[model samples]
Target: MKKIERGMAFASRHVDIFKCPVCGEGFEEVMNGSFSCSKGHQFDFSKKGTLYFLRHGVKSDYDDIKMWEARRFVLKAGLFQPIIDEILSLIPEKNYLRIVDVGCGEGSTLKYVEEQRTNREDAYVGFDISKKAINLATRDEGSAFFCIADLAQLPFASKSFDVILDMFSPSAYGEFDRILKSKGLLFKVIPNANYLIELRHMLYEENDPQYSYSNDKVLTLFKRHYPHAKIKKITYEFPLSKTFFESLVYMTPLHWGAAAEKIDAALAKGLNKITIDVLLLIVENN
Candidate 1:
């Protein structure tokens, strides 16, 4: 079956979680492969089986197809398996779950999570601002409900989700709080100082300011929003092949601002192994 057909079926099963992006009204049902709100604002499912919720187009540096494909390649190679395991450990052992992945690029992470939970009934929804990313996400049939949505203004109903996953993505705490249940958990992952250090060194000199990194500001901001939030530091190294290293180089935004020569240098130098250092912030909505 086509993606739009799958999406329509999925929406029919879980239509209550969606809200009209324009009018903030609940979607009553799926009609003609589209969701129509009480206010008459309708969002049609694309041929790829994804919904577009952004009122206006937003361009992003991550919109390139090659970048997203590279990311999907790396993720599928099991480089991020450890992080995914940690996220699964935090989820409650419930019979049913409603989960959303904010800024979920290409839906790889969400798809992995869905695959791991075979015995339970769970609803997985992933959204990103990049249309290309969402389109790529729909390639995997029955993976999840993918959509193009703005994090600043989510198109989900209030208190609808049991868990929120933000993996290496920007946070919209206010929108998170609104969509998450009162006791819902949010597992946010942010890069640490030593994350991809090999590439960092290649991109800049020791004395260059960009060579060093810190997550102090991001931690402080998160703490300010969730004073009682818990943090877990995950650090490890994954061996890399020359082929896989190339994917890593293109998948990350770390090279976006670097000079062409620097990227070329990094690719030429290659990497034996890459560090996977990140902090996982687990917060509960009170």
Candidate 2:
């Protein structure tokens, strides 16, 4: 039997529940039932019993190794320490034995937390679509599974994970919902509107078409799959340097711009500092 099929069969035994906020529709249990919309929008289940209803299929090859290395440096510099602290604080006391990091890039966050956490042993799986990312994560023997897979097609059983980490990555809500158990928690770390204000100021046309408003956008998207969603926002200032400037230049989404020439000119002024406001959402499976 295929791995996914086995998971679905097991999940069906538990009798799962689903709801779509966009349509105000609910299904008591879809353990063995088909998933569909009245407007003919239907999503089929994988062998693992998770449904994928991704309307858009956009995946791209990330930047080169130099870019990845820069991101690794910034994260390791502890500039985003506030994010780490908030995540540790919100973690509920539970006997959660399985955890997964969706779109886990290079596994730095998971590696750090695993060292402090004795709550669960070898329960961490850092999954990403990029084999380069997965290879980097697998080097950490502390982590359990490192796989190159799509979020919309998670290779796990329904209600299998105790916690799902969606940190600064594309979210697959249906897959997240399918993989989490009733008591499971999803820790989503989204960028607040002012996340990288200095970069925005430098890149955008007078701070218009900003990336600052992603918090509400993300919440709105996820509220479609789960109820009782709430956000916890944290703002912090990071001391910067020449290396920090390089890291920010390439690692951020702000790097893409039609006004690249202007942005480069602004950055040359040797302005060596910035702040980040992040939203750490702790949404429970309600």
Candidate 3:
């Protein structure tokens, strides 16, 4: 069988999670490699085996091939292992579960977390806005299903997931809540002001006011959506070896907006290590 066909076959197992983004009708996964809505909206599975649900053309900065490539390399180095360990610790010890990762860049984090799971009944699926990222993610075909999708208008049915992961990704809380089961958990990981403190300092001047951010508004919004949410502030410094430095800077969008010369200058200075400061919010879909 062809690669795309096999991919579609694997994706067929969890067809119930999806609905027509255009008409809101449930999809029928045709074994021939397409998902069709009752209203005749048909979506094809790419040859790489990824399903695309993004109706609009790719517009995100993450759509670049280099970004995904860099992410793939850096993540493979286990730089995010500490964060992955915490994520694993929070997962409910269940025999069966559905875990959906939103904006799962190249599926690194999802794949890593899924690897630590001994439960064979767990179903892991990830979707992102970038086709490049989805392509990269599908390399681990049977491990998890990867698709190109919109975060705001998720193509899944209401209450389709047991756990929704929003790590460093944009959130559509209403949409997220709608698709998450009543008993579902949303594990959202947002960067703190100190996240990549060294990188930010390098990107801007020491006294540069824009070098920092305020997650106060973000916290307020999150609390408004999930009143009983439990927040864990995870802060630590991870050593960065010279081997991973290039991928580290390239993988992150933290310094992408800076001038090339400035970035080069920062690289010239060399980085021994950096901080991984983030807020992990565990909230119920209730």
Candidate 4:
């Protein structure tokens, strides 16, 4: 089947999870390659088989195709596999699951999760604000669905999801609380001080404020919101190829503000292995 047709079919099968962003009405049908709600708001499926839920254009540095491609390369190299495995281990075994990956850039992580659990029946939907990201995400034919959406105003219905994955992305707790089921789980990943330490050292001088990093504020805020949250620290290193190293430099935002000369210097120096230090916060909805 064509990409649009496959997307429409997926939407038709799982239309209950969707809500109109404009009027908060549930989608009633998928017709003429579009999803429409009873209130008359229609969202058309793109040629790539992805839906756009954003009413306006939102500019982001992550909208670059090259950056997303670089990310795909790095992720496919198993650099983040350990983190993904940890997340999978935490998810409760079930006959069926409804999962949504928020800020799902390029859909690599969601795709990996789906690929790991082929025996079970589950619904996987991923969304991001970047149209470019969603377009690229839909390129791969998989059971997972991709869409362009705003994090602040999610298009999914309330108490709809069994699990929510937020990987190195900004948190929309209000929207998260609304869409997640009563006994749902939210797995949020945040970087630690040593995450990409090699890259950080190469990108900035010792005296530069960017040379040092901290997640204390983020942890504090998360604890304030979910006082009973459980935290797990994951630390490891993955060997890097020359090509993979270059892709890593392009994939991360750490070098975005650095001087060109510094980035060049880092590339010239090269890296053998990179550290992956991160904290996973697990919260259960009451």
Candidate 5:
């Protein structure tokens, strides 16, 4: 089947989860190139099979195709399989539960979980602000719904999702609370100070290894929003693939503003393996 055909088929399957971004009405159906509401608010799906939910032009560094491609490649190596396992473990054993992934760049993390799970009754939706990311996400996988939408203003209905996955992505707790059902689970993963420490060490000054980090304030904010939040610190080391070494460098924002000379210098050192230390927060909407 064609990519757009697959996309429309997926849209047809989960048309209920979408809310018109402009009129705030439930989508009635998917027409030729767009999803429309009864009130006539329409959002067009791209030829690549993804919908754009942004109301305005908002450019970010995450839109780079090279970055997302690199991310797709590295993540396929299962470097963060532990986190995926934890996410799957938190999911209730049922069908037709709505799951949304906020800031789902390239869609690899959620795709991996969906592929691993046996249940096919659950509806999976992924949202990212980058159209590039969403395009890549929906390129081949038509099973899950993909939208280029903002975190602050989700195009999904209130009390819609059963589980929200915020993996290394920015969070809008207020928006999350508004969209999730009561007692809905939110699984968030934030990088620890030691996450990609070796890469940081290589890209920056030798005197300032600066590998350790604190999420105290982040946790405090989560607790303020969701009183029943639980935290887990996961730390581990994984060997780097010889082939994906360059991809690892490009896949992250860690080296974003670093001087090219410095980046080149870091690459010369030849990083072998890196640390994967992150804090996973499982909070409930009340």
Candidate 6:
């Protein structure tokens, strides 16, 4: 994947002595301030505050500005604001909290959380593998420092954070374990099977909807990784406007394969409102 922007250099930690978040191993090198494991795994260092350690490159489908803009519009419409508030309500109010947001596209979720948090301590880090997403996130959400890095191989040492937020983003259980402090909490927001049925129904054409997802699966994944972790799920629906319809399409990977002609047709239909089903899970970062 290509790196798209030049970010302002921010102070960063030198990843020296630590084990690989994914595989239990020790670091052997610290080149360019990045910690390298002896197994030949290398994670990128951020001049702006963290590391990109996800093994998978950015998804080719989600590497555009159009999708981000659409998401921005939909979120700005307050469709997901209540969801953010709900997550905040569960987090304990504290002064010196270190929070990390993974796959933070265009930084809307981080921005909203930042606004809602009663008092913040230390740092707010938002990282993603997509430079496009990180750049946009940094530009719009100045309060949270942005980094273009993989989540599976985070740069920080183990037990470094208080809270980790993963909203509609991919997960790296081991990496999260390494960075989260014992007793740290993680809030993950995923979609139910019928997340955006309207778009999926129209896009799928004739096939039965293929939106296969299960909160139980997420709970199981979390349990497998952190047996001591506690899980709580929150589900809600919000109305989306015509503008939201456009943003929702772009912001998500649900309709990436639709032909341009078909997409144009869908756009012509122009929805007055759509429904959103958001699932949020909070877990103890054992």
Ranking by lDDT: 4, 1, 3, 5, 6, 2
Per-model TM-score, in order, reads 0.97, 0.73, 0.94, 0.98, 0.93, 0.77
Candidate 2 overall Cα lDDT vs. reference? 0.64
Lowest summed lDDT window (length 10), candidate 3 = 2-11
Report lDDT (Cα) of residue 70, candidate 5.
91
**Which of candidates 2 and 4 is the stronger one according to lDDT?**
4
lDDT of 3 by residue, 1-286 (tens): 6668766766677778889999999987665668787788988888887788878887778888887888898887877777778877887887678989999989888888777886557888899888888888878735677888888899999988999988888899989989999878899988889988888888877576657877888888999988899989898887787657777788888767777887898788869988989999998766
User: Which lDDT tens digits does candidate 4 get at residues 167-251?
Assistant: 9999989899999999999999999999999999999999998898999999999999999999999999999989999999999
Question: Can you tell me which runs of candidate 5 are displaced by over 4 Å?
Answer: 206-212
Per-residue CA lDDT of model 2 for 51-138, tens digit only, reads: 4433344466562555566677787788666787677667765554566887877777787767657655536666666555555554
Model 3 residue runs over 4 Å out of place are 207-209
Candidate achieving higher TM-score, 1 or 4: 4
Q: Candidate 2: where are CA atoms >4 Å away?
A: 1-59, 93-96, 118-120, 207-214
Per-residue C-alpha lDDT of model 1 across residues 153-255, encoded as one tens digit per residue: 8999999999999998999999999999989999999999999998888888888887989999999999999999999999999999999999999998878
Give each model's whole-structure lDDT: 0.90, 0.64, 0.83, 0.92, 0.82, 0.67
Error of 2 at 23 (Å): 29
Order the numbered candidates by TM-score, best leading: 4, 1, 3, 5, 6, 2
lDDT of 5 by residue, 1-286 (tens): 7777767777888777778888888988888788888799888877777788889998798889999999899888988898889878888777778889899999998788688765667778898998888888876553777888978788888898999999988899888888889878899998887888888877777564343456678878877886778888888887876567788889999779667997887776666788899999998777
For candidate 2, give the lDDT of residue 243: 67
Return the top candidate by TM-score: 4
lDDT of 3: 0.83
TM-score of 1: 0.97
